[model samples]
Target: CLTASSNTDGATVVVEPCTTNNAAQTWVQNGQTLLVFGNKCLDVTNGVTNTNGVKMQIWTCTPGQGDAAQHWSITSTKTIQWAGQTECLDLSGGRLTSGNQIQVWLCENGNANQVWNLV
Candidate 1:
C-alpha cells in the first residue's frame, strides 16, 4: 500500500501490505499519473534518481509539467514506466528488505525487481 501520512505534499510514498479502505492508500489514475491522498501525484524526489534507495513520494501535480519524473505509465506485462524516461520502479537489492525504499532504475527485461502485479 502507498500513502501520504498528512495527505499533503512531500509525504513519502509508503509501501506496506494493502489494507481495506485506507484513505491514505487510495490512488486515482488519470491517464498515466497516479494521484494519491488528494492533490499530490506520486512522484520522485527532485524529479531525478541520482542513485538507489530514493523512495517514492507524492507532490502537487503540475497541469502541464511535462516532466518525466512526475508522470508514469504501465505495461500490460506489469511494468510501471517512469514517464518518458527509461527508468522504472524497482525493489531495492532485487529483494525485499525491512525499510526498503522503492526506487527508479534502468529497466532490466524480465527482472523480478521491476515487475508488479494487481491484487
Candidate 2:
C-alpha cells in the first residue's frame, strides 16, 4: 500500500505491507486534491514538470487549484497519473516488494507495478 512513512514534511512515500490501522497511509481527498497533511501536500515535487523517474514527495501545499504535479487522475483501468503529465506513478524497477519506492514514469500498457488499487 502507499504509505506516508512519516508525519514530517518532505517525507518519502513508499509501498509498505498493508495493515489494518494504517493512519499514516490514510488520506483525505476531494477530486484530484489529496491531503497528505494540512498545509504540506503531495506532489511530483509540487511544481517540477514532467520527467521520468521523478520521486513523488510531500511539499508545502500549492496555493491554488490542482496542477499537473498536484492533481492525480485514475483511468478506468486504474492507471494513476499525475495531471497533464504522460507519466504515471510507478514502482521503481517495477518492483512489487515491500519498501519499494514509487516514481513517475511513462505509462506502460499493462504493467502490474503501475496498476494500483486504492482500497
Candidate 3:
C-alpha cells in the first residue's frame, strides 16, 4: 500500500500494511494518475529528471496544468511507471517493511521492487 505520511501536500509516500478506512492508504487511480488525500497526486519529489533514487511525495493535482512528475501508469507488467517515461516506482532499498519510502528508478522486468499490484 502507498501510505501517506500525513494527509497533506508534500507528504512522503510510504509502503505500509493496508488498513480499512484509512485515508492515507486509500488511493484513487484517476486515468494514469494515482490520487490521494482527495485531490493530491503522487508526485516525484522536486520534479526531478529520470534519475535513479528520486523519492516520491504527494502534491496537489494539476492534471494538464502541471509537470509530468505527478502522472503515472500501471504498466502491463505491473510496474507503476512515471507517465511517458521508463522509470518505475521502486521501493527504497527493496525494503517492504512499514515506513520504507519509495523512489523512482529505471524499470526492470521481474524486479520485485518495481512490481506493484493495484487493488
Instruction: For candidate 3, give the lDDT of residue 7.
Output: 72
Q: Write the per-residue lDDT of candidate 3 for residues 1-119, one digit (tens) a residue.
A: 87989877888999998889998988898877788877888999998976999889999988563468888888898899898888999998989899999999999899999988878
The model with the greater TM-score, 2 or 3, is 3
Which numbered prediction scores highest in lDDT against the true structure? 3
Q: Distance from true position, residue 67, model 2, in Å?
A: 4.5
Model 1, 53-81: lDDT tens per residue? Answer: 56777788878653566788888778877
- lDDT measured at residue 75 in model 2 versus the true structure, 0 to 100: 83
Better of 1 and 3 by TM-score: 3
If the candidates were sorted by their TM-score against the true structure, best first, what order would they fall in?
A: 3, 2, 1
Could you tell me the C-alpha RMSD of candidate 1 in Å?
A: 2.5
Question: Which regions of candidate 2 deviate over 4 angstroms?
Answer: 37-40, 64-67
TM-score of each: 0.80, 0.84, 0.93
Q: Where's the lowest-lDDT run of ten residues in candidate 2? A: 37-46
Model 2 C-alpha lDDT versus the unseen true structure: 0.74
